[model samples]
Target: MATIATVTVPRRTPRRVYLERATYLGAAIGLAILPNADLTPATLGAHAAIAGAAGLGLARAWRKAQNLDASSLKTSMRALPFLSAAAVDGAALYLPGAGWDALIAGGWGVSMALLAPLSRSGRPLRQAVEVLEAIEEPEPEGEPEGGPEDDADEFTRTIRAMWERAALPGDTRLYKVIRHSPDGLDFTALVKAPDGKPVPELKKRDVAAAFGVHAEAVTIIESTGGPGWAEIAVTPDAWEAERDKPQTDADWWAHNIGREQGAAPGSTRTGKAERPGVVHHFAKMDDPSEPVRINMRKLCTAFGADTDEMRVFVTDRGNEFLVSVFDQPPLADTVHATRELITPNREGFFRAGTAFDGRPVNGRLYLPGGAAHALLLGASGSGKTQLVIVYMAADSLDGATVWGAAATEDAKLRLAGAHVDRLGFGTLYMVRLLRTAVALMDIRGRMGQKVGHDWIPGAPDNAYGRLSLYLDEFNAATKCPRYGQEITQLGERISVQGRKYGIGIKVSGQDGKVDDGQTSTMRNQLRLNGRQITLNVGDVSAVRRAFNGLISAEDMPEPLPQEYGGSTLTLQQIADGAEDPEDAQGIGGIGWVVRGGKPVLMRTLYVDLGGDDREQVLADLFPDTIGRLTDEETTGLGPLLDDWYAPDPDAEEGAGESSTGRRRRGGGTKKAAARDRVKTFLDMMPGADLDLVLNAVAEDGLTEADITAAYNELTSE
Candidate 1:
């Protein structure tokens, strides 16, 4: 056996320890001297002030110590010396005698010295050299076997290993395990990045790979707890099950009412037990006053469903948003327009289609006391033309005067059977139609002003009623070199000033790009105060432009599939030389409608524009006859119509004739006619302001540009 030795190590006093001891000694001396001091007013005041300062210092020290630790007894013990000194000083101010001063100073000195042992600031350090010398060296042992891996839980260990394997920036550590089930796990975590480095973006695919699960099994969103935190959930099989499970009316009802309804216990088929529905398992009540809320986003993630598959709709009462889950997107199915659907409701809102959440998508052409313009943007095969047809039919049925302008011959043929008060084709005809619309808008405005109110849609005395201008393939006319500038100016004016007069403009185009023949002024005026709908566009940027950046690329509707729900021709069929199947052209009019300055994914009602029944459908959809403009409403429109039909001066004698094959008597031009018309109007309305004169001549179907030209020509003469 080897002998063991022990050695004593002396304590070394720290500088702070010495200073503390000196402070106590100084207090003791001050107490001793204070009692013998001269008994004068100044001296007494000085003594009391000094005592007060000391007492304040002690109180501050006690407060600081209390804040530093929850152990009140330990704090009091640490502050015992200062407290005692303060008490003695305070007593010296009232008991001014040498004997009392001496007694207090001696007692203070003894108490402080006795408590000195409690101070650990000068604790003794082990004498390393002496200890080493006293102990016998043990035989060298083999390298100690490494202890079992760190005591962290299995989940934590797995997370650490996965983090390292994924090559993710920063160290990911489990913060808390929110839930653990046989199907999945939910948890929050903290990411510790290296100094001066930002938290790395954790891609879902990478994280899933690290966890040996599919990408849809994982969800990561910013934690509301704080920055540098993330909420993660992993549901491996739940998503697959959710996708495969067929949704039923019961499920819809359960989600709508935030409760689970089922057959009651111990009840026969004939008679079932009556009981109140129980709260939904997934519903959370964050506040008693609020409706039961469900985490729709989280549920969607867990089910591996898209936004369209799991949606929320406001209930009929509008008190809560009810969740609706579907095996397939409801909008994927077509919703045909019906008489009731196209007809305006009591509030004058037409049912466009069903929202993703199974709620009716309603749209109105008029605002509270004014009309509203609309802009529809979509690419080819996006069903935009069909949607416009439906809307036009609705407007006609609603008793509005529908003016149609088609830039293409095909568009003209499509609207030929509809109840269009005035249907024009080609850029020339389109420009003429626009000029006429502007004149009518001005006339309506003046009429409203005369009546001392804005135009009302169905007022008994209202003569003009509602007027809607529909422009199909608007880009074609807006891009025409000869008429694009004038068309753009006229469209802008109508978009800005036509609403109050019950005149609205609806323009359909391939995209909303200003550079694509649509001037910035025209796009802004239309989009700023008008309703916008965007179907499957050519690109993400087009969607952004359509909604003025309200919808981002990620939020855009999924591209319209080539073959919607229909099956495509199989490879085997193709190899066998089978004919291609005629599938649905687009995603049943899938698109987005901007509501309340936010883009909401929706689908417009589908109207069958193809097949043999197309003609009958058009006839039934639109009125056979529209209310014609009365004689008074057509005032001054003759010259504009004549100018529109005026033959080209450059054409041969026979070819330079109007559409009705009539020749101008004096070989006069529309500009010359406008000059005369304006001269006559100004003469009749003598001393009238420019506005009054313009209003008086607006019924003549003359645009502001035409009037301005006539004015310039007359003034120059």
Candidate 2:
């Protein structure tokens, strides 16, 4: 994140444009007057010296002001000789008859605005547009050779090959695949008699030959979808013989689709009503021997649970019929806990548990290479609150101080080992808590500098060992007139730079969109921190906000049904506020985890707040921490801040970066003061721009030119 006003073209403004024009004009004028200094070797040497100094000053200053990246800076440095050469070319072509040479010969033709190259205008900030695409896209498994991205593309190809094989001249083509996965393929295509002809029933040996599986592993669904179409579930013999099979949510849904879809207008079947392709989305078999025309729009609509919210259906023409539904039931088959998750390691890594595909997930979010924070977007009853509780419990048990901020005044949690001194809820206390945290962060930074530490959380000297802030119902709080500004500022600071100070944040909200008037930088930084946990938001908008437009309609998480007349409400209804939150209790604990730089569907442990197993469930989750936060002494913090607040009415609201956001400079001593300055500026402008930062820098008595010089010297290399 370097300032690279002059080196690249990512960020641009009127000032940068003016500076560029001035630069060309300045060079043009110098070229227009050069050779008349006797046209001698002495003059040539002086000219080269002047050009070198000018190039270094201008390049370094612009780089510092605009925060150019290293690559761009290197490019500009390589062009330095060209700049001098261009001036020489201009001097070589200048007409001495024009009298511009006569003035230079008399040593009186020096231009006054030539000094303009030294002004802050000459060093105008460069627009740092990130042209570099992300080099890494995280995916689960099977990629030591080519990687998961290649695997995904290959998976799409597999679908094409499967359909072609199924459409073979003699093989059975009576199944439409609804779900595809490495484990099994869920097919919806029926096997009824064709017109007046009798349908050939699948034989065990024939099935084995067609599917490339053993005769013993071939299984058929004789219960649902009338006579023509039957659900076929194929698994390895090893997997089937196990006592506890790897039954997933997709498996659960597939096993129950018969009951949900009502046996597809039944025939004389006598088995339990189970749909043929409930787990169609998880299917991954290839037996096609003929071509299949895949109609994605129609198939997706038919396959999806909610029609109104289901954007697309199944379509296939070789490689175009798949939907990446990492959020739905079959994908995020089940949920586990911190015990099954959060594997504490000496390397300071934690295995966060499985993604939708049943692959292990580990996220070191607070660590240097991690995203620094986790952003959650879930509608009410979408498991946002519960997940927050789990995260807090995990960190608390791992010896991190957890600071919580909620919109309610009387928030109570059954956290087992939480320290009460860190809990702050409601608007006022939340503000005080954040401000105090900011102050603490500032002080700790100075302490870390003294101890020669960069990011050693939980170190003995670091009193606030790995502080994790969990802000529930973040959007609702952001709408507050007075506190909205502060919350936004605190959050932005912690997210953008907190990785180095043992601080991290997890912000959850009903919708993922930023407030209407939020600045671009804040929004970008918010999205930039990609460790997102998106639950069943039940809306296309929330999906886009969380996944960044990389998902499909059928891929959307199926809305959790309402208690009574559950099918009557749609996810859009819940997202648009038409459906009651109480009614839309969210479909289980299914969600997506976009940590490790990739989106993977995941589910948290099953939790029903009103169920009788609540206590036992909590106990199971945190045997050591459950009910451990009973008294002040055990909790470590003094007491719950049920009543604590202070208001600064005169404080300007909506300022993004405050003086409290410490900006690193030349020395360790200035760290606290820099943070205070950042806090002060943010108090004035919620998300301060370059103008605001420069203004604050000036106000602090650090003159712009001197600041520029220092910054250039520090960052130029």
Candidate 3:
């Protein structure tokens, strides 16, 4: 069976309606004023006729706008009173006497002005008003969509409109499913694009773009009812995401730390008094992209929780803030313990520690193409030297070629081992040592270029066997007179080229070392692919310079005690007493290790230097120190007799007599070359243990007599 569709035609507005709409006010006012003003019958009649005709013509013109006649149900109500008043006044204008007619026209004029805004089709005008209203107000337009009607019915109407819009191929219908108001529509939206298709439930970003608010402020939900339908909500998340971002000190306290508003003045609703929260910013804070355990302190920084008494507590789980700033932390301190440092070096790992909650805190500076150099820094008693010793022990024990230079034979200067192939001391000698290193670096660079590859990441047993220059108190070496600048410049060159040549420079120093451009250049080169430690500095400026000015000193931990020097303290140790009056929040650590251009808190290892471990370590690396050489084996150890002197020119080749003196028993008159060897060896070591030197001389293949003679001659000098 075929169905017939009914066609409806739009109704045209009457000409009078358009005429009245345009000329009603003028005509009414003129009629009212005409009665009060002096005028002849011809003028008054002509004016009345003119006004009426003009009103009719205007109404007739507006009548043609039939498409604009769709009035809203509510807007139609507003149009009613005006239309009625117009009718009443029109009747009064005809029925009343002169003065009363004036009153009626004036009344009509007032009604016309009020009705002007509603003159267009009431629904279009209502929608247009709603759009304007939504923009003009802070809240959305969902507020005024309802009137005195059953909410369920209103909701049904709303959902039905949504479905209709969503189902439509080309039309727009913005109706709320659930307006935030208790009696507003339900959570519903029938979103459709201009392509005559329903827009799918969008992601947060899309929804935010659609609604013109922040992505964080809008929550999107894909309703289960149908396709291309979703719900978007407005929330305060955008504002909350920016917590801990204070524009000023007072702003930080007022907005981030505590309540911005207190109970109304003297109101009965008064509660707790206001207080400032102690602020704690996390060092080495994790990135938001990485998963982190939720905590009060992290949350406080995340979505501002404010109070002056905020106490921060750090635990294995993460950092947390408490309501009481003076309370103990939720976690315990990590105590140091000793263990034999027996671990062999592995790929990407050169050092490991048990300082971080008993877990192995591995230190690695091996990049894809180079071995890591290192810089150790700390104040006195802050453990910088100890750390250096630990590192050297590890490297030496692993068979790395260890070379050391020091200004004095201090305790930290004692790193002698089998792997310590050579040592240099004093300003001039250290400068010479650095100059030699610069030459070696040049040689290695040339070799790499010739071989079509820069030598790097080579094993200890590789061609180079991994050489490391451990410079103790690098600042002292850089201050050598007449050679300081040369040393620094050469050091910078080595620093730049060393990493690519199976070589690394481990430099240790206190503050004030980087006082020159050469030092600064060397520091920058070391910063890349170099392991680093920076202990506590007494002043803010020091920290800023040490940390490269990326952090604020106010956010750093307090300075160390006066008695302490060169030894690092853990966060727990510093916190133990820094804020005794307020135990709420604290972080204490002696220094930080630089990683990826940021400082990570130092996790120092507990090295076992006890009898057995120390002996074993020494024995493994220095078996020569385990026993003494007999004196009979060192009797004749001195300048070799054959090399003691040059030939006497005046004497014949075989003659014992010469121009200066008789030829030596083994050869010509004596020379300083043989004695110089012994002198250089003694100077390089300085105050060497007698037995150890005897063993060294024995290892050098010197006979007992020669060894003893060399030692006696060198000591006497």
Candidate 4:
């Protein structure tokens, strides 16, 4: 009412808009009149020509203006309604009745009226043209003043820089910031590749580096929404918060007792009459005058109601108490039952000890129908050597040949009385033992081929019985300057291929990394196919390296303290030389074993045969009968052993050899000489088999062992 004068809003009309409207109108009129006026071919022909002309004009207008793509599926589908109407008119030409013709005429008129651009205000044509014209125009360059980049925080910029530095495929853009706090940042992102390429993986380390944080601080996981999408989180302060929030006594008791919340200390004491043997005593933290005693039965029910026995003791630090629940008193916990668990079970798995929950800790010498290499990793005083002896004893009891090697003099002395078929005591001996194992593996492989099957336990025809090679201080042996390469090569061969031939390898190392030399390949193979036992270590990294990330640092076993202080003997009694507690000496059998592809906490069996004498204890646990190899099985191994035992000819004439004997430096030269001799013999006896060559070389003072070694060396070359 305020504006008396009319204000006109200008509408921009497309080029040839009038011509397009006229063409459609003319075509509609022709089709409507043709159905009513004529049954002649000329009238129908005229109608068809008009419709064709209209379609041609509309297509040209669209192309010239660049408003729409003529070949697009959208454009073709839009023409369906008009085409359907035309088909009905064409059918009317062949119909005999006038009723059908009239009906077709009406349908054609209605379709054309709706489709035709009758005016600038016609909705169908006007809306379509506007949309197409908008699409044809190019979008304005550059983002608006308050665009995404301008609004993004420092964390977002850092993420963008990280993607660039990592050289990840695609253009990653932040979709939304879910959170941004001093503690962390959480966000979702979209990755778009050029020309529809796939998005590349986002590694955690790359993201961490971008934010100047640790790898564990950042987490990058692909979104489940679809491809080319990911969810990222960066938390620098989360670790500190978790570390500071220590678990309280109430929290620990609640978790252990399988309760949502801990019961009030004094409240539970009143219900002792209803729950007999449940409540013992309780005291408030603020009241020091009150007596303090914990209910044993209530704690026992946390493990299970049927629990009959429990052992409670304080840690060496006096900071916490540990309660071990057991259904039956663990036999391995006492020295009196030492022999009960050392024996191998029916399936050939040795009962090493019991877990904290009193489950049997069983490990096998060989995997029966699979690979049976074992890795024992722990720090010194972690009972690793004791566990190794248990495994050796189990194998010996099963009639398996046990070959032992120690990297140090002390280790050698400890294993001296074990049921070893062959024992090597020092670095040189360890290397020689490895080489012999490799040669034996090759021989057994060949023997298996001739027998037409893999080695089976207790087979009558299988002369090469089960052989278990135990390596103590393996990390030290691998670091030897003269024989490290050869040792690594031999270890790898046995780890990869020895299992099928009834050959098993067990390695014990103080350092779980084994990074001192070329033992990485061999270590990887063992981790993949062997059972791994990691005892209390000095640090978390040792366990991580041993299992190759199969176990995380959070799950690593707690390191054993240097001193075991929970002794029953009083200070005056200790001065009297009564002796320290037995648990103190074997304080740390506690460790982890990989069971069912997961780490399980366990304590190895206590071997207390000789009281405090370590050597006597080992010797007592070992079997009385030692398994030995037959002459036939030790054919090529004899010469290798002879060379190992032989003194170094290069040593000074008056100097005495060490207890472990001098290493043979000229063994390589002798091996080269043997290879040459075998080559010369083979050149004369071409196409000859191993047996033929052995017989032919007999006159030359060459034993079958020499021939076999020489032939193997030459063939390998």
Model 4 deviation from the true structure expressed as Cα RMSD, one decimal place: 21.7
What TM-score does candidate 1 reach? 0.52
lDDT score of residue 341 within candidate 2: 64
Q: Which whole-number lDDT from 0 to 100 does residue 578 have in model 2? A: 88
Error of 2 at 37 (Å): 99
Count of clashing residue pairs in every prediction: 1, 88, 67, 0
> lDDT tens string, model 4, 592-643?
7766454666678765534468666665666678887767656644455454
Residue 439, candidate 3: Cα error in Å is 5.7
Compute the lDDT for candidate 1: 0.59
lDDT of 1 by residue, 1-717 (tens): 111122232333444455556666776887788767777897687566766766765676667675666454454555566566667877866785688887888788766865663253222233363256224321112211111122344555455556566676566544344335423443334443433343567777877776666665667876543344455665555655654588654443333333322211111111112223211122223233543333344445434443333232221112223333454445666788876688775455787767765577776677776666778878877888877877787777787887777777664245543466777667777776777766666566667676677777556776467878888788778777555655776676777778777888888988777764666666665666566777878665565666655544434443444434334566799999998676433454777776654456678887787767877767777776674665655663444444444443324333233543233433655655455546654543333345644643452245778777777666567
Local distance difference test, candidate 3: 0.47
Error of 2 at 515 (Å): 2.3
**For each candidate, what TM-score against the reference?**
0.52, 0.42, 0.44, 0.46
Off by over 4 Å in 4: 1-332, 335-339, 411-415, 458-461, 516-518, 563-586, 609-620, 648-717
Residue range with the least summed lDDT across 10 consecutive positions in model 4:
312-321
Poorly placed runs, candidate 1 (over 4 Å)? 1-324, 411-413, 416-418, 519-529, 551-585, 642-717
Worst 10 residues of 3 by lDDT: 262-271
Q: Alpha-carbon error at 54 in model 3, in Å?
A: 21
